[model samples]
Target: MATAAGFEGTLAALPEAKRELARLMLAARQPVPAHPAPRSGAGPVPPTALQARLWRRERTHPAVATGSHALRLTGPLDTRRLRDALTGVLRRHEALRTRLTGSTAGRPLLEVDEEPVLRFTEADLSGFTPQAAAARTALQITESASTVLDLESGRTSAFRLLRTAPDEHVLILASHLAVFDGWSSGVFLADLAAGYREGTGHLPPPELQFPDYAAWQHRWLDGPDGSAELACRRAVFASDPRARRAAGGFERGHLPVRLARGPVARGLELGAAEGATPFMTLLAALGVVLARREGRTAVVIGTPAAGRFAGALEGAVGQFTTVVPIRLDLTGGPTFRELLHRTRAAVADALGHQRLPVDVLFSDGTPPPYDVLFALHNYPAVPLDLPGIEVGQLPGPPARHLELYSPDPAAALACVGLVERDGEIGGTAEYNRHAAAPEDVRGLLTGIEEVLDRAHTAPASPLTPRH
Candidate 1:
């Protein structure tokens, strides 16, 4: 609905660093013409760009594209109600019932089974000792999480209930990442709890489904709008020479880091003074560290953006995430406060044009623009309250096979993920051992922490030589 003149006026108000990128996006923006409604009966619909990429990678490395969530329930649980809830969730989300049909050699299509049945496996470990039961439950959950889903057969979801005691049970839900994501995990739990409290019959069906999204995405990308968007993205990266370099090979290693509440609070305060969010603040700190470590004036980092900008897509669960490359310019030895403003503008510009699929940016075997990935997991917390049962969340199974099946296998030299819990920030830094040593990776994390401290304590201190 935005006119080109109005849009240009808005971009003109952004920071100087953000102007060019925003202008390119403005050029790509066009009035969306009315299109036919998405195909209803899903015989075989085209997959979203991200889904198709995952499907291809999955074929080469089976069993590696899986995601799972686990919950521990205390107090008596009614078996009938639990079954109904599980069935209701499966019936509600079509992505769980979808399968990839056709040969891998050609473009794959999605097929949804109208009346899919949910058949979850159950285990009773109450007979064993408490510790033994816990160990056995973990083993079972890991096995289930590692199981390769049969995409062609629509066997993409696995649910397991392990009863350690008559009143205690653990529910583990696993599904292919091709059809699921972090946001979907929260949706699944919320829907399940709702269905358990109020019978599934009372719940209204979602206005849209994942298949509808896929169909729409296909049409949009094949049209003039998609072409303009792609061109805009390509121009943004083409202007940056650093973004053209290839990523290093993969050799995964992890290091855990935690920041106390004091520094985190101060950092937040400093960022707020500059009109920046926590993500932008932390990203500025990261930029400082990378600039200092590599001794460069500029750096590019990749971050994931949730593509569920539409209201209808919010409740519909599916893989709707895209990796957006954020480029930072730190040439003038800017203070932490200055850097924060620059980062804020850059992130805003990138996210404004996130609808363009990242895969299309590098279709000719060119590596992803960034070698380091950053993610802040701020997913909505869905609380599950059954009538008399107390539900507690347990850490989900680890993604051990991510290295083999990751769509962007060579795109990341190191990846950093941060999550806030109990007033403290904790995260893991995963690095490619082939490219960086453990000690160096440790030092990089340490540097990030130090930069964060400096940002709060002396916001005006320059990160590099002012001259």
Candidate 2:
């Protein structure tokens, strides 16, 4: 037997070949499993054709694990009333409880074979104080554990409500983004409130179920030239050199800046008088932020555009987002309108090249090194009203984990997620912690907002607002 440090001493003395031999010997000594991965009920047969394709693709890349955003609220409410209301929400949304499985060859995918049941349980707070119980329950949910509520003490909650208040009464909920996006959050909240009312006998059933959207997506994504669109997508995705590499040295992932918080200074919008488009306004605002931060007049910003140019893929879920490069150059102390024009032209160029993949582009040639990544999402429509319950909207959840991890702060990118709602546009700026500090990130957004306010609030004509 080797002494505590004997192995290290022996290895240092031996030739590299001998060292390799010892490592192989140790590995061979370890037992190997005879089998892996258990197969169960063959779960939900692909209910729709689109789902079939997803199941096949996911066979190789298992659907990314789902995560939840939780909220805690304290209020005086009825338990039976809440449980009944929840059942209604669960029954309405099919994607909420869906799961998937497929063969090694990646066909004959399975889905809807078994409906994942709705989970509604209570916690026991018999011994601990109310606050303690609430704290325990919060941790339990955060750590992905199921808990039973002690209804007797006021420990009742749902995993689907988006917002909550804690103190005398609390309501909590969790949602998986795999089936929901930012746009859907607003709709879900509207419906939940309506659903609650219906549950308490305030109204009738909802006009439609989530499955309706599923059916619509199937028809929409499978429409004509959808294959062509995908071909173009392949082209774009294949263009990037870094994305094309067989391996990357970066660690799998470790999330820094876990939660980003700050007031959202007002956002930018195209006024009725101006012939400005939302994309143009967005690019202009971001250009200001970039210019302010880098102390450079000309800036390059990269944003992801939904490549679903064809209406067919409109409802087709899955990650159809593409990274498009937007370039904004300020020349001769350009006026706000001139700045806007430059921004718009850059956006057009990006959209034109959106078909090319980032990996392919990098492989062919490197992008001018500078600026940031700007992603704008025009997500699909989801139902906003359920038959019962009052739903509330909360701050978007912070992404705790990212797989495409990088330690190099200036590794040539920063992503800003922007979404336009009604007429107001709001978004979050995501940057590598190693590259951008929280204060710096906040300042960047503020600069954008300041410019937008300056432009929009100024005399409706060419007059700029007082900053």
Candidate 3:
């Protein structure tokens, strides 16, 4: 395995670029802007290229899908108040009330239904005697999310309640990716609580909506500054053989993996770099293993940078997700420790230019920058406790959620996703069954963890694969 056994000699043998990157990562700062993106029009705005792309894919793959937050609430629940809260949220966020329409003009448009009516269907499934309602809820989450949403009537979201016990029930809030995202889930829960507690239609005013962001994005990209940024980003990523091999090599499927979490936690706690995040450290480990497996001196991995970089859109619900491709240079034969520092620098640079739309990055499929997508899937798990009921949000990517919500299939990615498990961090890898095998994905996962464990112990180790 790669080791940092060499002291001064190894550090002295690094390339100029890598050495500079190491210096930068060691001193990088977490930049958080005080203001949010400005909003303009409140009326119907054009759908984002991402939304349009998803809408087209949904037309063909209607069975593959989004997410269902199946919450089991015990004790008493005010069904009327819950409904009112949800309706109020729908009224506030135009995304929930917006529909994708192509007939409006040559291009697609978001048709907003200001006073759209939504109701939750309740059923007493307590008849499944001796059978656990939680079991039923788990099985139905996939089916519930897979059903194609009717955008024509703006049925982008759905809610169903199954009575499991006199004091226990499952509240499933299913949504399509077109109108929702990882962050949006938390927004839904928070809004629901405010509605139920303060009463519906009584919340504060929402600053912006999905359409406003879309309009802003289009204007930015089409403008001179955006055009220059897009050109530069596109120029950086040429092409690679790894992307081809990943798409056409192995049998693809989901491999749900849970690694021992102590390494990540410890790594973060003991990290010498103050500004570098634990997630970045984890990603750097992932990049090392991937670079080794592919036998490529340079590795490219795509990851999603949330669209909520601006504070204003933080509360607005929409598909505000952006894809960021992180390219790691493993040349100059640097140690794994050096690699981590280098990876951190690369990520920071990418984030600086993340505002450049994903459309420009992968607009044309000719030169696929990356076949692997690595990300820390930090979906917020907000909890709610009302008098007698307790609520929780389920983490996703058991294949069903990723299969339905994963943004473009054109890249044909071998996704490596890290998630929090019982306080420690673990990983979940997924790929199309037609492209990769379960065992293959598992092997990759194991190798990645091995690399991570070793790095956590001593990040300066040489870049040698463990036997």
The TM-score leader among the candidates is 1
- What's the best-to-worst order under lDDT? 1, 3, 2
Model 3 misplacement above 4 A: 1-42, 63-65, 103-105, 132-135, 239-242, 245-252, 262-275, 393-413, 456-458, 464-467
Q: How many clashes in candidate 1? A: 0
Q: How far is candidate 1 from the true structure (C-alpha RMSD, Å)?
A: 10.0
Q: What tens-digit string does per-residue lDDT give for candidate 3 at 1-467?
A: 54545533554577754553343332223222223344432334567777777667667666344556677787788888888888888888888888877643477767688685785788876777746655676666655766567555577888888777787777777787777887887887788888888887576657867776776666566656667878888778855542553444333366667766666566565444635676776676677777777777887777877767777788888877777878888787677668767878999888877666575566775535666677777766666645668765554335443333234453455677777766766667777666566776676666666766776687666775334
Error of 2 at 185 (Å): 2.6
Instruction: Give per-residue CA lDDT, model 1, range 1-467, as digits (tens).
Output: 98867876887698754664454343235344333234433445777777777677667767767777788999989878999998888889888889887734486778788876786888899999999999998887777777887677788888899999989999988888778887888888889889999989855657778887777676677678778888878887775544323245565677776766677678878888889998898888788777776667888778877777676777877877777888899988888889888999999998886666677665767676666777778888888878899999887555532242234655556777788887778877776776667777666566767787877777777778311
Q: Of the pair 1 and 3, which is ahead by lDDT?
A: 1
Q: In every candidate, how many clashes are there?
A: 0, 50, 17
User: What TM-score does each of the candidates earn?
Assistant: 0.87, 0.52, 0.84
lDDT of 2 by residue, 1-467 (tens): 77737866776677765664554344334342221111111222222343333233333433222334443333444556666666554545444445444435453422331223446555544356666765665665554323332111122223533122332333445443334444444444545555555563543333432333333333333434333554554454343223111123222221222111221223233422245565676567767766665566666656656544444334322323345555567656666666666666677767765433343333234332343665556655443342232323334334422221111223543455566565445566555555445676666666766666666555234422223
Give the range of the ten consecutive residues with the poorest summed lDDT in model 3. Answer: 26-35
Q: Which should have the higher lDDT, number 1 or number 2? A: 1
> Which pairs clash in model 1?
none
Model 1 CA lDDT for position 52: 74
Query: How much lDDT does each candidate structure score?
Result: 0.75, 0.44, 0.67
